[model samples]
Target: MNRILIDSSVHHMRIAVVENGKLVELHWESKAHQSIVGNIYAGRVENVVKGMQAAFVDIGQEKNAYLYYGQERATTDSNPKEGRKLKMGDTVLVQVTKDAVGEKGAVVTEELSFPGRFLVLLPEDTREIGISKKITDTEERNRIKEVLKDSLPEGYSAIVRTNGAKKSKEEYQKELDVLLKNCQAIQQFGQYAKPPALLLQEKSPALRIARELYASEVDEIVVNDRSIYEELLQAGEFPQEDGVTLLHYQDNTPIFEAYFVESQAEKALEQRVWLKSGGFLMIQQTEACVVIDVNTGKFTGKKSVEKTILKTNLEAASEIAAQLRLRNLSGIIIVDFIDMVSKEHRHLVQEALEQAVRKDRNKTVVVGMTELGLMQITRKKTRPSLEQQMSVSCRYCNGTGRYPSIDWTVSKMRREIESIFSNTIYQKVIVTANPKVLDAFCGKEEVFLKELQHKFEKTIVCIPMQAMAFDKYHIEKQKDS
Candidate 1:
């Protein structure tokens, strides 16, 4: 039976589902000052950039929203003489596709989808009846398709989720009717609602999980929030089981720790994941891709070297798939398995990994192993990864994972002194930074400080601030007498 746990902390929220003894799905949502994405907006087109084939939109935010020309659907009713043209001051119904990161504005699209418990409702296009690829049973797929065909409006299409695989046609129709009503309400509201208005908002994380993740196998849904618990009870039909329970955690310890999930969560964030067979996986995530290296940490099998490596690689294959799902890591992923001598061993390890990832709800494609003993795979990215949502780039190394050398620090200090002396306004300057930078400059690079005094003709003082980052320093100009 599966168990769903929600950690609804004010700073960050995490949801984890455990099936049997393995972690299946985990998601983290950050509550930083940044606006949440997927929010529908009533936006005004500020400027139409014909050169870029896009427009800058004002969505009542600091940075203007970005709308690409490709996001606009081609209409057959467009004027033949005028062609497609969007001018300034035009009001558009837009939904945020991507969150604003760094300097880039939020990416907006007119194509919007509302997620329901059993199906995803697409209002604009609906002729096709789609089912999740995870549902491999042809008979179950046909059953869901028949339910959708009979229940949905003429213009709407429904993608039957994997959760609806074994459900009766009557049961599937009931869920579809709820979604259809919800969509109709949203459309009616959108007609009279002010521009830059929210026509629909997704349900809370707990309800969403119950709808999307809960199946007949789920033993219990535990929640700490009393209000949300009551809401879930009234929201939909929960799966029935003999021992199934809805638990309300009222302990002093956090809900995650009470369930012994905190330690597992902490382990998920670490760089190394160790298997019982003494093999380990070293995971490193970069902006471009995630790299995983398999190693035989300590296990020397009671067999030949080839057997040991193959055994370790096979074990790492299953663990790699588990970690990918638990962390929700996406984009290009390259896994370096311990090199094997046998062709059969390689094929077995590859098949093992592919079979494990096939159970994932999101689409995953295992492109097999490369000649360099690497396995390449990709998973559809629906949201920012757990790491991206919870952590920021380090300030000290500026994400390079290394601090500046003593010589580099001294050289930068000398340049700063020279620039400060040329100004001629400061009587003294205080340099403050981490102990390493200070120790490097004051201990090994003291000669450069002396030479800078001779060159710049100014008194420079360096004081280490223990609170400063390793590569960060503050400079303050003193008042001249």
Candidate 2:
């Protein structure tokens, strides 16, 4: 059975999907500090750069949003403005397309879409009704198309989601009514509101995931936070017939700790993943792409070398796909599979890897292997990877992942001592360094400390700072006793 655990007890929200007691995906969100993407707004045109074919919109954010006229042509061309270009102080309804990354502000568009449980209601897009490609059953697809064709309100249309395949007519009408009501509300709110104001806020991360994933495929939704649980219930996305259980965890123990998902999450952040076959995968992420190297760790086969390599490569392929989803690593991915001598074996591994990534909801393309024997993949990125979100550059290494050797650290300390005593007027000198750095001062280096004390005619004390970086040191002087 599949279970979704939502832990909102902390300041940030953590949502995890567990299938048969194993964690498959985890999503983290914090609304207070992060950018607000997918939010609808009434924005004011601060500046229109006709040459750049873009406009800077003030959505009441620190940096103005960028809206490309070329990209906006499809969505905004039908606006009442006709052919007139957006001018300063012009009020336009926009939705955030992407969040702020680095120096770039949020990307907004005039294309407004309201997502419901089973359909995405396009308020401005009335041209046609579309069906989800995943719902490939011809008869069911035709039934859904006919149903929507019969009752689709005039001047408004929607894209039927995959979850709508088995839904009842009453269910369709109920959700449609709610979506229509929201569209009318947004229009009314836009009428009263001025530019640079939020018309509708995006659903919280927990609620959003619940709506998208709560079809018959999901078994249960367990939320540790009462407020989020209540919100999911109010959303009315889950049907009780799917053995779906919604339980508000009233106990003091957090859900992750109880389910042992915290440890699984920690492992996902690691670069090396050990497969059950004793083979392992080394994952590395860079600005260019993500590279995964397959290795045979301890697995030895009684069969030929080719068989051993093929078996390890097959196991690595499965783990690689799972790791990508768990880590939320996207962009171009290159997998270095253990080279199989047989052409048939190589084909099998490639097909196995492709099938494994199908479990991931994100769109991914397996580009197959190159002549040089590198397997390439392209996965769409919706947000930052787990490691990128959780970690920062080290203070000493500054992201180089390297630090000065112990001998170099000791020599640097000597230079720092001389410079400090010559400039300052004080008796006792206190030197504090990381515990690892101080390890060099043990019996042998103690002699150097004694010499420095004699040369300076002052007392010098070495203290170990556990929390300090190995290359970091602090020196302080005191008055004569």
Candidate 3:
């Protein structure tokens, strides 16, 4: 049984998932006044590239929004147009599909779907009947599909969620009618509302999760906020007495700490994750993909070499799965597992990895291992990972783990002095820097600095400061007497 608890505050929103009374997953999202999700806009199609079948739309933002032709619904009002059909001044209704990232604008789509408790209403595609793949029962799927087929309107579609499984036909029918009514209301509102307006706002994250993920498998839903708990109870979706407990935490101690979730969350942020077998995995992420390297740290197996390698790889498989869920890592992932000798051992290790990842909620596919001992895997990415959300690049290392060399700093200082001499009328200049930086300026680079002083006809003095940072420096110009 798994329990979920949400802590929503003004600055940060945190969610903890406990399985078998132990914390398994913890997620936090910071609301720093820069949210770009679920924003609807009236965009002007700026440019339509015929070859790419895409257009760049200006949505009154710094960067242009992207719209793809395939994302647009097949409508009856569309003319079979060719050669740049969309013009510059054309106004279109667009919904943001992807948020604006580094150097890229928001990805918008013409076809929009509003998500309800147990259904996603697609206003454009009516005949399309879909169900969540997570529900494996064929009879339940067919039952839900039949209910959706009867209630759906022309030129609209409703995707039944996983929660619809095992629900009675009467219950499903009732929910479908309620959802269809809401969709109709939204459509009517959209017709009367002004352009660049939001017709339907998505539910809050907590409510959204409950609608999407809450099922018989969930043991309890604990929330720190009383108002949100009351709202969930009022919705009447989650039953109180059927082992689905909704707890309102009022303790002075933080709810996350009570569950030991904060410690697990801190471990997820680290680059090196240690395994119980004394082996470790170092993970580094870039814009392209995440790279994981396996290492045999303190593990000195007294067994044969082949056995040692197999044990390390086996340990890595489980840790890799846990790290993926803990960090919310997604997209292309390359794992460099410790090389094993036996083919059977390799196959067993891969199978172990597949079994370990079965617990994750997100869909993951292991594409098999390569000859170079690298295992390739892909996880569905919905948003930015935990690291990108919580951390920034180091100022000193600039994320490369290398700083400016002493010689480079000395040369840069000389250039600054020369620039000041050519521009200003200072008589003496005092340069203060760390011991290493000052030593480079006075030791091997002393001749260069002296030549610059002679050319400028200005007195220059080097002052070494031990307390200064590696990158810290100061230049002071002495007034003429």
Candidate 4:
């Protein structure tokens, strides 16, 4: 059964999707992060960089937002700021196209989109009309297009969402009207409102995902929080679907923990993943790209060496796709598969990776293999990855996962002592560092410490502090030894 479980009682809201009794997707949103993508705002252009063809807009936030000139301009005539350079004080209607990731601000666009249950209203332009690519039936697509012509606002266009395929004209009209009214409200508010004001707030994360991803084929939606449960009921259209049920889970245990999702989520954060065939994937995420190395851990095929290598690469390719989606790893990716001599084997692995990636909702491109036999895949990135959102950089290693060694620390300490003696006059220099660094520096017989004192021609005291942090130390001045 395809089921969705939403837990909102905690500081962050979590949504878990289980398909055929296996956890396939998990999304987390913190309540404090009010700036979600797709929200409409009345922004003022703060600055324009002509070289980059981009503008920084103020959207009533701490950091100024950014937007490209051709953010969503499909055609030249569709450009709202047509043939005119946006100045520092020009007002424009914008929407959050991408969430703020890392030190970057949210990305906004002049193109406005108001999404409803079965349609996304693109106001001020009625030139474009289409149906979802998922609705492949030609007849149904024509029917949807005809219905859109009638129900859509005069100066607006829309894409009939997949859920609208089987709906009657009246149903489509109702949703279209709601979206039109919302768009109108946003326009009215943007006219007189102050710059950088929010015109329309996006729906809650749970409802937004439900409407976009789970509108069809979802058997049940179970929410743990009572308020969110009631809010879903207030919408009053989801539960009306055939055989679809809305459940309020009031059990003592959290919804995610009870459904074995917590365990799966924990595994997703791991760097190494073991496949069923006993081969493993070592996944490392860097700033520029994600790298996955395939290793034949314990899997040995019954056939020749070529067969074993092919089997391992095929298995690794499939798992790489799953982990990318499950962990929400976006941007450029590089996969180093076990080298195969045959060209046919390489093609089979690439095809398997592409097939596995088809199930992902995000946009991905397989750029084929590089000269070094590494497969390159690029995925769209809006917000930070799941690991980045949930985890913080380490204090000592700064997220590199490797701290400086004792010998390096000792070297750094001596540099500090030398610099201190050259700059400041003191009778004795007291070096206070962590026990590990002190042990490595002074040694058991204080050989290094005595040599340092003799060289400096000043009393030097080594103080081992168990409570001190490894990466930090204090070189303080002392009048007496």
Best by TM-score: 4
TM-score-wise, the better of 1 and 3 is 3
Candidate 2, residues 1-481, lDDT tens digits: the string is: 8989997632356788899889988876653455476789999999998766689999999899998755434444454322447888899888887766546688888778888888888875464788877888999988887778767788787888877787777878888898999988998898779888999998878887677666426788999777888888887777686568898876534467677786797687677899898988998887789999999999987799999999999888888888888888898999999888799999999999999999888888999999989999999866777766555445566664534444434545664565566656777878899877776643355765676677678788888889986668887778772
**CA lDDT of each prediction against the hidden true structure:** 0.72, 0.78, 0.73, 0.78
The CA lDDT at 351 in model 1 is 95
Candidate 3 wrong stretches, greater than 4 Å: 34-41, 58-63, 71-85, 185-195, 399-481
Which ranges of candidate 4 are over 4 A from the true structure? 71-84, 402-481
lDDT score, candidate 4: 0.78
Q: Per-residue alpha-carbon lDDT of model 4 for 1-481, expressed as tens digits? A: 8888886732367677788777777776766464378888888999998655689999988788998874333445443444347889989888997888767888988878888777888876645786877788998888777776767667887877777777888988888878888888889989998887888888888888777666547889999888888888898658555667899997544466667666686576688999899999998888788988999999988999999999999989888888888788889999999998899999999999999988787888888999889999998886667676665556666677634444434655665565565556676888889988787678668887877677667888777889986667788888666
TM-scores for candidates 1 onward, in order: 0.72, 0.76, 0.74, 0.80
Q: Quick one: ranking by lDDT, best first? A: 4, 2, 3, 1
**What are the clash counts of all predictions, listed in order?**
2, 0, 1, 0
- CA displacement after TM-score superposition, residue 457 of candidate 3 (Å): 65
- The segments of candidate 2 whose C-alpha lies over 4 angstroms from its true place after superposition are 44-56, 63-91, 401-481
Superposition error at 463 for model 2 (Å): 18
Better of 3 and 4 by lDDT: 4
Error of 2 at 474 (Å): 22
Off by over 4 Å in 1: 32-38, 44-90, 96-109, 166-174, 188-195, 237-244, 402-481
* Root mean square deviation (Cα) for candidate 2: 12.8
